[model samples]
Target: MKNNLYNFTDKSGSFISFSAHRIKSLYLPLCNEILMSSITADLHGDIKSGQNSFLMEPASRADLSLSKSSRNFWVYVNKDQVWSAAGVSKNI
Candidate 1:
């Protein structure tokens, strides 16, 4: 089956959309809470390399998590709130 796609939109209205193929066994520092892993996604309808995944650290570390089943997910973050929707096929 094809992997599900994830979309992230920041407060500035910019978007970074992608899908994770295989979650890395090792984690790289993204911030105090989040880490980097190997994944791939489409940027402007073009498939990106596996090295293109970066998880942003949320204000509350407990607000987010990632795993193999994390597909068709939408994440919206701002200074006040962190919102996410899973198993949905829509864009912000």
Candidate 2:
């Protein structure tokens, strides 16, 4: 059974709907609402992890890493900066 649902939108403003069950077998836990919702809710407020800032060119060179756990959470960063938003790119 599906634990969640997703409605995807493209840059053109078009959207498509799909059942999470379709991909659940692949073991993509990000589709699980119980897990996803908790992670999202926890990211709110004054938590340092939720606060994101841009790093300049020199600062960008410092070794940066993210845990698999954090990779599942929503985060926004400047595309041109060291840490980038999940799927955004500077060229876009």
Candidate 3:
């Protein structure tokens, strides 16, 4: 199950930028809850690990979801930044 973290638009038609903290604290917990709830009815028990199994692709699919114009203005991450988010699995 892939999840897209997009810019939330307010009711007044203004785009609201969600802080990293908000994503980590609020949205992540909600995602965890849904994932946990799904696990309960998974007959095959496909979940090998727990909630931590949820992969956070900080600069891939999520980035693509942005508007094309927005993407053009994106600052690229350096090697260290990539390592911090992806670690050894990045090579794979």
Candidate 4:
């Protein structure tokens, strides 16, 4: 593998999730219910650590520096998935 190469995968969730509570004023009961209901059966069990299924927050340089254990959960957003949701891509 070469440097600068980013093989982003679910093994490493979102760094922004750390600041989940900072951005409030929304509702997410459905997500919490679904997650709790399917804990043992869920593929990624550790996701519930921070319990932030739909939280988005701005991260500072210090926040991003946190260790792996400090993270909430790992999220995998791949190219194929992106293109599928966004339709075909155009060449530059």
On TM-score, the leading prediction is 3
Candidate 1 lDDT over residue span 1-92, tens digit each:
63254454677745443535243232222332333332222111111122354233221212223333333444556665544444333333
Across 1-92, the per-residue lDDT of candidate 4 in tens digits comes to 54232333466642223333343321122235444211111111133324454233433333323312222333335653322221223321
The TM-score obtained by model 1 is: 0.16
Per-model TM values vs. the true structure: 0.16, 0.15, 0.17, 0.17
Candidate 3: 10-residue stretch with minimal lDDT = 37-46
Off by over 4 Å in 2: 1-27, 30-80
Q: What lDDT does the true structure give each of the candidates? A: 0.33, 0.29, 0.29, 0.29
Model 3, TM vs. native? 0.17
Error of 3 at 64 (Å): 27
lDDT of 3 by residue, 20-51 (tens): 33332222112343343111111111221344
Clashing pairs in 4: 13-74, 13-75
Model 4, position 45: C-alpha lDDT score: 19
Best by lDDT: 1
Error of 2 at 67 (Å): 24
